[model samples]
Target chain A: TQLLEQSPQFLSIQEGENLTVYCNSSSVFSSLQWYRQEPGEGPVLLVTVVTGGEVKKLKRLTFQFGDARKDSSLHITAAQPGDTGLYLCAGVVLQGGSEKLVFGKGTKLTVNP
Target chain B: DAMVIQNPRYQVTQFGKPVTLSCSQTLNHNVMYWYQQKSSQAPKLLFHYYDKDFNNEADTPDNFQSRRPNTSFCFLDIRSPGLGDAAMYLCATSREKRTGGTDTQYFGPGTRLTVL
Candidate 1:
């Protein structure tokens, strides 16, 4: 079974538009991470939120950990063509001990210029 | 300089044949991970090594194996490849989990494996 689920498997919008991608789970996580991957490349770590209700911002991208620790969201303000890629959400369970990373299906965003 | 590097960005293997993917890191991180990602799907963890110790996820297939002979190098060995095993394999490096921010992974460009 998939531990995490991301909404809007794919999205395409004109440049300068705002978009929010969500990650949801039925289980609570100790920490969650966001990654962006370009074609033919590995995913790059964008941000990580460890505490429930924690929020982190990177440039125009804002990341928020759900108050319940069971969900998180990535909001990109004024999306640009550069923002086009696959966005993935992964979480580490509190159980800890080199366990497998639980990943969401991911969202593919295409910001057309 | 590349922090993480995987040899043969593209690999083709015959079904039922054995194949090995190699990853080396310049970051000298202590943890190395192997993940498989299909088109538009989440990257799934195959296994990982922390130093010389190997940890396998319960659901991973027995055909997949990994070895980390040293801190900077890790290897993924597929005992028997199948058509379903065709996917992009990503290698990632991370410092020990206790190192906070370093625990965030740095990934290689990934090797796309084609199993015929």
Candidate 2:
């Protein structure tokens, strides 16, 4: 089974502070996706990085995929309380016409105002 | 807007009772999935249907079952609910990408199940 290990399982920072979360794996994936889930809600996709060494930014958030396709990272600049939530990284592996995603335990972020 | 929808945002069931959760989609995707997520944990895929084909994960418990009666709907049935079965059940849908690899999965708000 493919496993993803996320670092710093918990994070607490003040508003306007910067922080980064990392997801790493020993196996390669066809694509990697980032999702943010708030309490009482399902996870919402943030972005997907398919290419190696690719970087995509969503306003203050920047997401990067490793060149080897074995890791990914999410960087937030000037974080706000709205960013407080659980961040999950899922690595997608395609099997035949179907696929499965292996998710990390997730990083819980608490942004205090 | 096309999206996934789940019924009964919350459900309460007694131990050993059977409970069913429903999911529907407007996207007409060919694939629908059921996942179980415990508090502060990652979501675990229970099973999924590709068109009419049902696929179950190897480690999934036998008490868990799923049905996709048609293209637009899917159901998750948990037999003999236990305290361990109490968790958020999420339904997701995705269309098979013509370009290959995995297609983007759209998720529903999920149904939080409480076992008493």
Candidate 3:
């Protein structure tokens, strides 16, 4: 079975601090996506990276896909309390002729003021 | 705006009681999915509908079933709600299925199920 492993399962940092979350996998994916989920709510898509070494920025959030398509990362330049939530990385994999997402365990981030 | 919606926001059921969770979408997308998310965990896809065709995940429990009676709505039925079944249920939709995960899925707020 293909699996995505996320590092720093829990992170707590002060406002204006920077942090990075890692998502690694042994299996190559066709694409990777990052999602942020607040408590009591479903996840919201932050960005999707399709190419190896691809990087996308959404405000202070930066997402990068590995050149091997086997890993990804999310970096926050200056996190605020509003950024506190769960960060999940999901990879698109073809299974039984159909494509589906395999998600990482996720990193729970708490940006304290 | 066109979006996915889930009912109740929160649901409570007795152990072994049957319950059905509802999902509706105004986006008129061709695909709808059901995901189970436990606290501090990633959303796990349970099943999905591509138009009228049903696709079940290999590991989804037999106690769980789903129905898409029409284009705008889908339902998830838990035959015997176990304590382990307590989790947030999310419904998402995509316009169409694409290779390499190009299809973007919009998610609803989710329904949190509590089993006692």
Candidate 4:
């Protein structure tokens, strides 16, 4: 089973539309992070949400951490073509007294012009 | 700009051949990590170094090896490349071990490996 599960494996939408991607898990995480990866490149850190029930906004993108720290959501307002990419969510999980970073399969977002 | 850099953006090797991928970071972070990412999948952790202290994942194949001679550079060695080993290899670095998820990891463009 995947430690983190991201919904809508793929998303295609028209420009200026709004959409949200979700990452869910059964285990609690100390921290959760969202990353955006462009084609032929590595993933880039978009935001990190640590505190439960916390909300952060970056430009048109908003990220929220679940109150239980087991889930996270990313919302994009008026998505543009430039926002097309793979959205990955990662979390820090403690196992055997050590912390490990786990990643979800990721949601491939495509915005049409 | 201080950043992570990977060499040989693309690599092609014959089956059973050995290949090496190099990563260097100017950020001088103490933690460097190597990840394997296949198409339409999440990046999988292969191994990492915390200032010469190597940490390998339990499932990482024996064919994979790594070396960190210094803080700025790390190398991933594939002892015997197979078709299944073909994937994008990503190198990343962070200021320290993530405790609160505040330490952001910086990644390189990645090296695409092809095994025939």
Candidate 5:
């Protein structure tokens, strides 16, 4: 089975601190996506990285896909209390013409005020 | 705004009882997915509907069933509620098949199911 290993399952940081989360996998993926989920809510899409070594930025968040397409990272700059949430990484894999998403256990981030 | 919607944000059911979770989408997407999320764990895909086709995950239990009556709506039916079945049920939608690429999924707030 394909699996994604996400480091730092839980993290707590003071507001304005910078932090980074990593997601790694042994199997190569065609694409990877980042999602943020708040309590009592479903996950919201943050970004999708397709090309290897591609980088995308949304506000203070930067997402990067490894050049080998087997890993990814998310960096938050100057995190705020509002940035507290569960961050998940999901990779898309194609098998026999069917595509499925393999997700990491996720990193729960707490940005304290 | 166009979005995915789930009904009965919270549901309570007794063991051995059956429950159904409903999801609707106004995004007019061609694909819909159901996921079960336990505390601090990743969302596990139970199944999905691509247009009228139903695709179930190989490891998904037979007790879990789904139906997509139309493009706008889908349903998840739990034949018997065990304590392990208690979790957040998330519904998501996407425009097309990923194939060898990625398709962004929009998710609903999710329904919290409690099995007593």
Candidate 6:
């Protein structure tokens, strides 16, 4: 079983539509980071939410950390075709500098123009 | 522009052949990490280097080895490439924080490997 699970394994929508992706976990995390990876590339960090109940915004993208720090949510308003990619939420395990990150299955979003 | 860079965007190796993937960072971060990602799955951490200390994940196979020769460069070596080893290899770097697990990692574009 994956420590982190993302909902809506796949999403396809028209341009300018809004959507939300969720990452849920039973285990608590020190910090959770969201990433967007395109085909043939690595996951790129979008934002990081450390504190429980923290909410961060990057332009039209908003990220919220659960009050328990065990979950996170990403909401996109008027998502564009450029936003099409795999969205992954990753968090570092309690272990030391091994820097091992537990990743969610991912939500693949395809925005059509 | 200081960022992580990966060499050989695409690598094709025969089965049982040795392969190496290179990653470099200009960010000057104190930590470097190597991850193997198969199709439609999450990136699995293989190992990492903090300064000169190497840490390997418990589940990482012995077939995989890594080297951090200096601050700016890191290498991932596969003793023998197998069909299962065909995947995207990602390199990430971060600065060590006193807070430990809260550091945000910056990732490279990645190297795609194909074992034939």
Choose the strongest candidate by lDDT.
Answer: 5
lDDT of 4 by residue, B18-111 (tens): 9999999999899999999999888999988878889999899999999999999999999999999999999999888755446788999999
- lDDT per residue (tens digit) for residues A30-100 in model 2: 99999999888888999999999999999999999999999999999999999999999999987665688
Poorly placed runs, candidate 2 (over 4 Å): none
B-chain TM-score, every candidate? 0.94, 0.96, 0.97, 0.97, 0.97, 0.96
Q: Candidate 5 residues B20-91, lDDT tens each? A: 999999999999999999997889999998899899899999999999999999999999989999999999
* Number of the top-ranking candidate, with DockQ as the measure: 5
Candidate 1 regions with alpha-carbon error over 4 angstroms:
B100-102
- Which run of 10 residues does model 1 chain A get worst, by summed lDDT? A92-101
Model 6 pairs whose backbones collide: none
A1-113, model 6: which lDDT tens digit per residue? 33898998999999999999999999988889999999988888899898999999999999999999999999999999999999999976767534458998899999999
Residue B82 local lDDT, model 2:
97
For model 1, the docking class works out as medium
DockQ, candidate no. 6: 0.64
Off by over 4 Å in 6: A97-99, B97-101
Worst 10 residues of 4 chain A by lDDT: A92-101
Model 2's C-alpha root-mean-square deviation from the true structure amounts to 1.2
The DockQ value obtained for model 4 is 0.69
> Each model's TM-score, in the order given?
0.95, 0.96, 0.97, 0.96, 0.97, 0.95
Could you tell me which 10 consecutive residues in candidate 5 chain A have the lowest summed lDDT?
A: A93-102
Task: Return the TM-scores of chain A for each candidate in numbered order.
Answer: 0.94, 0.98, 0.97, 0.94, 0.97, 0.95
TM-score of model 6 vs. true structure = 0.95
Clashes of each: 0, 0, 0, 0, 0, 0
